[model samples]
Target: MIKPTLDEEKKETKFSKKYWKYDGLHVISFTKAGLREENQDGISIEFELNDKLKESDDRLKGYYLFGVYDGHGEHGDKISDDCVEHLSKYIAKRLYELPIVENEKEIKNAIKKGFDDTENYFKTHDINGIKGNKVRMSGTTALTVMMTPKKNLYIAFVGDSSVFFMSSNKSKKINIEHNCHNQNELLRLRALRQKGFMYSIKARSGRKYLRVKDDLSNEIQYTRSFSDFYIKNFFSGGLIAEPEIIDKVYSAFNLDLLVLASDGITDRSKIFNKHPTEIYLSYLKRYKGDPNRFVKACDEMIKLCDSITEKRICVDDMSIIIIIILNGKSEDEWCHIVTKNAEDPEDWDNTTHEDELSDIDDQDIYNQNSNEVDDFLVSVPLSTIPIEYYDEDSAMNFTISDDDNFD
Candidate 1:
């Protein structure tokens, strides 16, 4: 069956972003159930921006927010299987409390804390046979983006999921992959693969303990997934479980739009060998870079996979989130303010805090080039689409249109 990717859903929703010099948004789309039988995936997404800011400060006014909850392979279905429920709701609730710090470190700490809290909650209320088991392997991944006018723009990933920043200057993978089997991940896993045991006390009242196992061959390689019962001990439920994450925040960094998605985009990444970040940039112009169009393209690709595999190999759950950054400020007013400065420059300009953080140059990244991906390949596509999948004209009555030019 033909399934939707994170990008596809974005095509359905559109929000304006002209108010703020900087803006941010949030979205959390969840997974659908019974995919294994129907051979389809389910998803739900929510997008919102800083509505309150419109009164507090003109520059900090209305913006857009969108989130994604994409499940794939077995992961998406498992969420409905009760592997990762309510977690999506919980995250959406938390993001409603925004105007999050304009500072990068503060933003990072906030996200870290949120994730930690989610894990702690999951540990306490373990799912059915899904926690503390010795052989469970169920988990979910998350991709997120935070942007502010002329402030900081940051994107992060903790699994195979990804978020892309598409703009004129550059299009790149701001989010890092944290899959356990990634080369770097494998090396670290090997180190943690086997070991002995130890214990240490922080002080008179604090204590800690450690236990190490042997290498993969000698030890049990449950990396694929821990038992359903012990899932708690292995992966923190509600976590985007992968490897060490890659994060960045820029002072002058800004974007017209943010694309957050799961591994389904990675499929596109594979075809282009283009990093998820670059996919938007490369195709933005070609696809009018509209979120819906981008996703429709991805959905079409999913169908392509189905055609190739004849519905057998890699049928996966897909999801995406598209955030159009809008300052929700008066266009005429901002023009006056910016133009006022243009006519007469001043060191005391209060427009923004540019260069408030380290300026890191875009690197000659060590990424798997899309062109080079063809050299190492095997193909098995499994995207079967029943006729009924598209029978619905519009799930949300979003005023369909074919006009692609929106920039």
Candidate 2:
């Protein structure tokens, strides 16, 4: 697993110029390569409000954007990098172009169109690679959330990357994992099978697997993602690029944290009989509502995962975005955001705000280098097949073994 050293953390103590704080929200984010040879995950967090908002459209105020992408196959990284870079533009265009009314369905349609346009853009253009090889046949999962000051939270999710909205008491999963084993996903594949677009098979272990069939009798692991035109061509309606959109109204006060993470973090097996959310909540409690809860959480993840026996460690690239809702909001902010218990003042962890640090550099925290994690040695081979685990705890943990080889 990739673990940051104290020196690296010290050097990065400077607040990223892009880091912004509004009336009651602090977005803290980080992505690590984990055990993967290459970091195939990509994340983006943007607060397009106040000075960050475009002058032409001051109406775009109070908009917060968060995205996470997990790449698969050899050219997976490019797919994620491109998806995030372009999707942001598409989302912004829709936000600014459409009528500003809170039309949840319309906004979701716009986001779907954005994903389509991005995928099409990849198909038409050639992405130049270091070895002069054009990236072609790769796919990535995408998850995006848009929070408007209008008290609406919109989510456009595809593939397996997970999204969780955490309040003081519970953290609810906002999206589904589009994989062969998921019951909903299985239903989708079955529906497509009726159209002769997809099929399912049972392995020797009696485990059923969904696959997009090819002319050569090859059965590829099924995923709804952007690109991988080869699968698109053969699978009929087999693979989809359309994202599932979910819209909800949340109160600023009731919400304690919003977590967006790649499958690497969520898809790990249970350790010590603890669920991922339970473990995460443990860290949140330890931090006592600190603003840098995300940073501290990631650090703990590295430590815990590294300490685990090799077989149970999370091996894929891990990325996370933590939206911490600061205290001291007006009564109006708490109206719709109902909460059972108010946070205790004594529980607050008082610490210097990162932005107030004297030696902090003006570099952006969400820059490209934010996800380029290093320090740990060894990389696991890339994997595309989703491992199915019956138990929820097992589902959250991934096997990261050095001796394992992929053909």
What is the lDDT for 143 in model 2?
A: 89
TM values, all candidates = 0.49, 0.68
Q: How would you encode candidate 2's per-residue C-alpha lDDT over 184-278 as one tens digit per residue? A: 55566666655666433221111221222212113333357887777777776667787777656455556666778776666442223333444
**True-structure lDDT of candidate 1:** 0.34
Model 1 C-alpha lDDT per residue in residues 264-348, reported as the tens digit of each score: 4344334333444343323333344343443443344344333322322223444444443334534333223222312221221
Model 2 ranges with Cα > 4 A deviation: 1-20, 49-55, 129-134, 194-196, 199-222, 247-253, 269-276, 289-294, 308-312, 327-407
- Deviation of model 1 at 375, angstroms: 22
In candidate 1, position 121 carries an lDDT of 56
**Best-matching candidate per TM-score:** 2
**236, model 1: CA deviation in Å?**
11
Model 1 spans with C-alpha error above 4 angstroms: 1-35, 38-101, 126-137, 148-151, 180-184, 196-245, 250-253, 275-313, 324-407
